[model samples]
Target chain A: MINEERTKMMTRLALYETKEGKKELKITRYSPGDYVMLQMLWSFVCGTLAFVIICVLAALYNIETLMTELFSMDILLFARNILVIYIIFIACYLMFCYSYYSYRYGKYKKRVNAYILRLKELYKHYVQNGNNQNM
Target chain B: MATLLMMKEKMKEIYAEYYKVIVPTVKAVVAFLMLLAINDKIGYMARLDSFLVVLVLTAVCAFTPTGITVLVGLAVILGHLSALSFEIALVALAVFMVMGLLYLRFCNKDLILLVLVPLSFYFGVPYVMPLVAGILCGPVAALTLGCGIVIHYFIDYISVNALTIQGMAAEGTVDKIRVGVDGLIRNEAMFLTLISFVAATLVVHILRRQSMDHAWSIAIFSGAMCNVILNFMGLLVFDNGPSVFGLLIGTIIAIPLAMLVGLLFMGLDYSRTEKVQFEDEDYYYYVKAVPKMNIQAPSKTVKRINTQRYHTNQK
Candidate 1:
């Protein structure tokens, strides 16, 4: 009886080991809040990059001279002003991104901590069951 | 009373999960209006009018919940009206605003790239390209004229007007020819806008699904296809004669075209590879372990044995 119980516990432990190996296959759904923050950060980066690239090309090609005839402002000044405005906009956006992510990460950590506690309880239960069988 | 309480609890859980989705959707609507206001295309009054429209629509959709079936219908009508008012800026703003708000509300930042990618295309293709052409044309024309004058002094060809070449006219035709041209321009703009909207939506939908691990491509494709169908229906009702056959054919063509555009323009499948791991120390075990067990366990067996059994025992 003792040997059978020992063998059973060993088998169960082995099963758990195999399960652990396959844990990555588990589908973890994101909380919608986290997903949105990440999306915003991505758009911010892409938008800024695009704005920067366009500004650079406009400067390099001296596209402003083409516009000076049509518009009141000098091409170089207009480009400079637009570039400055975009830079400020991008800086503000980055600030928003940092604050938002930090708050979300904090919330996520709390949820994860609770999850860990539940798992620890399950682990305790499995251990107790194994010990009872041994007795 | 007990059942009611349980139902309330269940509703709360659903709300918790859906809150992210709802917040962003509402925010997007608000932001789009704000953008319009900033752009001066829509006055405060118009923004207020649209805000009320969106609010009413939201309330109706929320109450019916099943009204999602009609979302595309509403979007089409509003989108069309907005476009007619030359409020494309407002519409674009609304799209991004809604997308941004939703991203913030839902915690889906990665999907923003989906919005940005298409936005870049929209701005790049329509506005930037035209501006570039306009800018470059003068210099090129000047160079050509200068060279011609230097080489062949007798050869004379005055450059075509930039505004005309750029397709901008101060005064349009007022007679039958005017009507025909107006009709053609309207049709062209509508078609282009439809294509652009569909393309953007498709790109976003594909990215969203791939990001969310959703298996509802059919639903999304159908929804997008429905836009063209709805546009045709609007045309029949409001504008020209009813062409049911044309509507069907347009939908058939539009669906594939939108999909093709989406596939070509849609960026990386980053969502597939990017894993969002919760780093909380306390919940780490639950997040990492319980979900594994819950998933690995025969799903049906766990649902039947654990949740149902627990409910029954409690009862």
Candidate 2:
């Protein structure tokens, strides 16, 4: 009867093991620097959208006849300019992304690695306790 | 009155946190220098008769915590916006006195080195820019200088010419340079505003992710509302129909862009699964902590169990 009860308790604890592992993994995956990158990207997108919308409106209103004229003069040039501008933006964004990821990875490795180490120690303690009792 | 008192207490907490990160002396110095430059620029541009009012407002901001200072500063700024003529010299003197008081009261050797040494450029550049290029060039120079700093991300340089404006220069000397996306989109003020919005949104997202309450949502909403109000104020000041329409269009475009970028950058999956999980976490924590006695009873538990089983299977 005691053995049966012990088996039930062990099963219950086992059920939570997967969940606890999942939680720790999730925590490790996200960091403050990730949030910062998200903020930067969101701002860039918003600012770009704002610029594009304003440009479209200005085009519609014929606010800058000169720009329209220039566009008409060389469609290829306009497209090229747009492409170059977007490439520059992408490069800047990539630089920010690299920095953000490195920063977050450093934090994760420092703090969360220590946490995982502590968790492993606890797991070892549990295993040792269980083995001793069994013996 | 009670609410106001509560708010003041809350603000004190916020100030304490802010002070931990950014020194009060640095904030005061930055406020003083920025305000002084702004005042000088405005005075040079249109013979702003209320220069003293601006100086006084700047002084108030430097000495006090941010909240009341922002309010007083806004009032004076609004007055200046209305083209009211006020005593410039007296306001300047008052502001100087306030700066002096802040220095005497809060200044320490370490504090001075931390605050003043770095901001020497922030203070000195604005003052020197106008002297070298004349008064009308100040704001343009300031804006350009700020943009250049942001662009380099580490280095500070002065590159913007103030005499580029037509009214500031001799006839036929005003070069009508082609305004490209680079020029239009690179305005420091607008960039800073967008950055601030992003920061607020990030804070909100992180708070929500941590299964915190909707307080951050309210904060972000309030910030966006401020931007909307400022946009309206911009419309009032500029009074250009197309520009106003463009701003509205810009806002409309921002929504989807924000979502797209959030998904791309933060991996915020806005699907039903994530939403349900988040809601479940929030509800579970709240109910576990805040009791409703036997009124809700076992039905709540049963419902939660059912939902949990469903989620478990789905996962």
Candidate 3:
């Protein structure tokens, strides 16, 4: 059964190789908010991972190459540099996330509110019969 | 102010009129420059490295189908590699085959650009491709962009380090292949560009969809800024990169190119936002309208100027 399911998945993947198929295969059950949320969530994870990995690599470079020649005196400085970079990365990433989320939410909220008002107006008109039809 | 606005509208009309021809021609130039850059950097055959040949082929490509251009360009590169050596040719062929497989799987209109973009970057003409991709393509195109960067950097890394490559070749086939694979993995620039393009694509994609004034311009500017800043940060962290002034100059050039991409894809006028409310038997509907901004194609209707002829015949 597992093998059969895997085969089905593989077949679907192959089928969606074409442009039309890919477009047809979109998971449109979610709202734009959910879509954006998923996008940001993945981006955040990827960006954070990238920063951590690069900083680790930088630290490794410092230890393996610069430490033997420059000695223990600069160790504190190297560590400080890594900390500063990581802080900068965090600050920038946070700012971007905050701005992007707020912008999306602001517009989404406006549309949703407008929809609610329209629905309320319709309900009011129905309660008043044809006298308030224009409402 | 009214006159200036009128002039701007007129200019937009003229721009839209020739956009079809212009797009293909620009793509052709980009393709030609990319092919030439690859040939100059990595080609083995001196005879096939002629400027006229690439120019003619690219010109023909502009008129022909996009697939034809891609095929011809690949064939030329393969031919050059074969001239260099059978082993290297085989290596390049394998690379091409894999990319071709991926292309088949994606089956996208970005087939030509999926390869050409990274090659263009390798030549220091990176401004156009990313901006164009960001302006026009979806988030999924980032995957193709990543693939392009890997192939470009891999091939470039091998071509530049002849001594290491030749030494590895002397050892054995397995060693040679290992060296190529290792170089690809170790390439930091490739990773940086991949990240930059992906981020830019996402930012532009989202921003362009917003129903707001100046969204396109904002998207273009921000996307360009993101690409420049990301690449700069990557270089600073990983390797010795271009100096600050050089970077600044490149960014300056890039913004306008990005703006051009924005203009080509998004019309000059803002798409007016509309809100409407309606009620059905079951429920009320609130709809937001966004209009597509495009120019109507020029159409012709012929009417004979026969009034004078009819008058003369009547007389």
Candidate 4:
């Protein structure tokens, strides 16, 4: 699945190499959005995990006085409480992930655009110089 | 925002310029503080506790590596204990031996925290230390923290039970062992802090291994919470009249401190794990490449203002 995705990404990206003393370029474009998505996914996972640990630890503390009756505690009620906390935490984390991703993606896109522009300038120069083989 | 960022970059540039001098100076200061603390808290040898001696040794340490400072501090502490009481010194030795077997082999720089951990504890914000260790170090830090706990507890135990222990020393050997064991096991506050920190370090260390963005932030937040909560529970369970407000405020302070530590150690970097297949003359090789995190500190170019040109009025 990942290999397929990589191939798909490769198809969309501009790949350039000098092979046998000839500059080869296939028609493609550079996109920073793909890697930005990967970064976003990573951020979301970490954000969720952080909130989860915090909530769990807090709940563990709040219930310590009742540890003697831990096993006898209401099972479904406990699950419901945990589930509610998890849902709330996850919702907040998602909001954080969205803002974080937007900020980071903007910077990533700017960097990638600059890189693409540099490559484009070189390509234009090569084309303007009569394919650079006329020499 | 942009101006703030530029100012931050300027400050970072200035710090980078003197990092060589700054880092060593900080290490030496830490060493000196540790030595001074040991002298004040655990010193039994009168001569070593002198201000002149501390000043000279600390000045010497300013040019030396931090590891030597940790050794010097621990040596003075243990040496003092030995002079005061043979049994406590032997116990301290046993703790160090355990630390050697468990932590020293894997960690060259871990011992420096021996003083730092207790310093944090003294400051009432020790939860930050485990988060710092987890984000910057590895599991071996747990042993260092453990040794620190033993050191703090050893001092407290000696101070509180000094007169009683003197009486016990004239009694049978069984009574001495009993007293030692009781102090180790029954001291709820110290053990609680130990369990909390060790657990926090382990948790943060494990979470840090995940290939996720914001891992350090997550680890710090989570580990700080874990430390705070565990200590709270310990207080409620063991100590009479647990102060919930104090615990909450400490946790609040610790979380931000841990985050600052995280910021100092970790920055956001995008890393990709890629697999490539290539053939050599003899065989085909499949390689998994995970690039290291790239750190780009804010760099600024310096421009000369030419103060000599301003003095051209004289010319």
Candidate 5:
């Protein structure tokens, strides 16, 4: 008395819901632009923090030398060089995040669309079987 | 060969049927081993070094994602280092944060390599990681392998210099941090290992991606050879590099282990390859299909008749 096709379809849906579907479904909640932008923003913040940590470590490593050269060192030039490096680093990080998240969003959207179609098919199966009449 | 293949088929069947339980159990075992190894290397923190603490953490790691294991391992490393020297712990934390926030965010799965490469070294089979990484992962794994090598060297440095580092507790915090950072960066042997590992991984990944018969085998062999040659060269160039005997023995052990891992992941039947030409609307397509070497375990069903019924029928 079981509908084999329905059973198979339901199983597939359940498996998807457990696996990658968990992440992909959440992606579907956001517009593609928003999702990519959010990712870029997050990467930018993390990248900046990482840069600052590296800078602090470098400073700590050369503290003795820096202390000796503190008065003699060209503060403006040092600031400019660090700024330039920071700009280049964040630029590369943001660009990568942008491209990666954009592609990922597109792929997830395509998958979620397929999943929706399968859900519709399952609903149709239920309707055709005269079950879940309210649906 | 036949028996091996049959055993592999049986293993595949068992794995397929019980993978849900198997994966977590393997995670738990690996976590436990890793925690024990860490404690053995540097058991500065008595509380974290306890067997009960490790078992509880291992149990949690079994149910959590693999990345959680890497984080737990990192936390344990920091705990031990902090107990030994607070400044060194800060230095280690900074390095980890840079790696995590900058690189690992995009490919966090590679975090496991941070745990694995060190464990492999502890087990005296260091070459397995790069060889397996090359076969199983993309080219980007070279970077991850390099990072893992750096981490291994850092941990090794910490354990070896724990007493000296503790002696520097009266020194300025910046000086201690500088010493810790210098110890990591100035290691010529670490640099050599990093170069060798990265080179081997790249070679394996590149060769494996080629469209050729016995590609995995060729890749594994070539990768192993590449690792040995690079390490040999490193030994000659660097005054203090990895032990030559360890290099040879590790490669000897790694070749077969990596090959076995490759076989499990990709068992292709190159002899049964099929090359066909077809035309699409836009262009002609020449495709080569390679079959996988998959053998399902034989299922035997024994049917028994009722003894009394059989006897009556015979009568």
Candidate 6:
């Protein structure tokens, strides 16, 4: 006789393991701070690269005018302005990453905790059936 | 109504029975249409303009991940733009890079919105994107749709100015790039559409989340109204937005399509709603459960009786 409850529990566990459980298992291995920091670093790199692409495109668009104004241009002021914009842009992007990854970590933690609870319940059922298993 | 529901059930049954084949077929059809639209809009490259090439690419897109289709679409667009001018292609690449790095990374699942929005605009039913996005997605969809609007305008600009850009070939590379970048930046119509669509998406998203009867229907209608009103207002003020008549016609056509999306995705039978209160160790939950509008296909029984054999046995 198959135990309907055990079968249902096993099915649920198997489904989770295949779906979100794959990511959640990996996520739970890291501390929340570490995960958020890692994501923020990624965001910073992408933001800087995108900013450079935009700046290059803008320079190319104004190539003729830039060539003429090259001698008279206040190079320091222009550099400073670009730097300020980059700083502000990357700061905003990093903050967004921080919030998003933090929220994800919290959610994944809750799911992992629930999965552990289900595993414990399954173990208790086995123990009641004279299976001396230690998790 | 019952007959329609029965048909829907039967169709759903058929879909479930042949899901694997149906999915790839639908994907192929969609990819084929999108590629054809691209070629029609900006087929500067002679090689990619052939029907056989599109069919081959569509076959490839059908079996791969959906993101592959998006990548292939981008490649086709770039190929056409490069034929016109390398600078224009570079400008497009930069814009796509910015959109991808900043906005798209956060919500990759909504990438299909990028393709659908431009395609809808080509079909003159652009208003459906925001309405459908509002019903099905969250606020992030507004940003994705905005990116789509930008792409449509970029393609439109290139198509409209292909001759002008080609005529300026002897002027210098700087002039061509400047014209391409400036056109995209100075496009008031694109900005207007972007703002209106984003607003409509947010309105629909908010309204559909309300716990009321016919909320999705109300949300879709209100979203359509918001889109129409905003576009009309922008047109009256800016005088450079989409034509008033086209805007009106598109919104009128979009309302029913949006309703169909809502019904298919979120149709609920509210008459059988159940409200229950339960308490657990940490919290008390007040839940309202509304069943989905589903009609199972009725089963048929065919019983065969051999009367001649029965008569022989009796004899």
TM-score of chain A of each: 0.50, 0.51, 0.52, 0.54, 0.86, 0.89
Superior candidate under DockQ, 3 versus 4: 3
Candidate 6: give the clashing pairs. none
Candidate 3 wrong stretches, greater than 4 Å: A1-135, B1-28, B51-56, B163-171, B240-245, B267-315
TM-score of candidate 1 versus the correct structure, residues matched by position:
0.30
* TM of chain B, each: 0.23, 0.24, 0.69, 0.74, 0.84, 0.84
Instruction: Give the C-alpha miss distance for residue A92 in model 4, angstroms.
Output: 42
User: Which 10 consecutive positions of candidate 4 chain B have the poorest summed lDDT?
Assistant: B265-274
| Winner of 1 and 6 under TM-score | 6
Give lDDT tens digits, candidate 5, residues B108-170.
Answer: 656677778889999988999998998887676777787778778888888898877777757
lDDT of 1 by residue, A55-116 (tens): 44334244346456647667798669886888787777667666665565556556555555
DockQ-better candidate, 2 vs 6: 6
Full candidate order by DockQ, most accurate first: 6, 5, 3, 4, 1, 2
Please name the candidate that would achieve the greatest TM-score relative to the true structure.
6
TM-score of predicted chain B, candidate 5: 0.84
The candidate that wins on DockQ is: 6
* Candidate 6 Cα deviation (angstroms), residue B45: 0.8
> Candidate 2: lDDT over CA atoms?
0.38
| Ranking of models by TM-score | 6, 5, 4, 3, 2, 1
**What's the lDDT for all of these models?**
0.38, 0.38, 0.62, 0.64, 0.83, 0.83
Better of 5 and 6 by lDDT: 6
Candidate with more favorable, higher TM-score: 4 or 6:
6
Candidate 2: where is the Cα deviation over 4 Å?
A1-77, A115-135, B1-26, B44-119, B122-315
TM-score of each: 0.30, 0.32, 0.53, 0.55, 0.81, 0.86
Better of 1 and 3 by DockQ: 3
lDDT of 1 by residue, B1-315 (tens): 344444444444444456556655754553343233222322223543465655554445444432241332224334433433322223323333333332323332222222222232323222121111112222122222221111111000001111232243323222222222233234433443334344434433444444344323453454445445555555644563225575455445545544434332234211111112331222221112111111121225443357877889999
Name the regions of candidate 1 deviating beyond 4 angstroms. Answer: A1-43, A46-72, A131-135, B1-74, B77-79, B82-315
For model 5, how does the per-residue alpha-carbon lDDT over A15-63 read when each residue is reduced to its tens digit? 6675679999998799988898888889989999999999999988898
| iRMSD in angstroms, per model | 15.0, 19.0, 16.8, 15.2, 13.1, 10.2
Interface RMSD of 6: 10.2
A1-135, model 2: which lDDT tens digit per residue?
Answer: 123333333333433333344454564576756655664565466445544544453443344575659756787886798768766765675565456546645655565565556656646655665534433
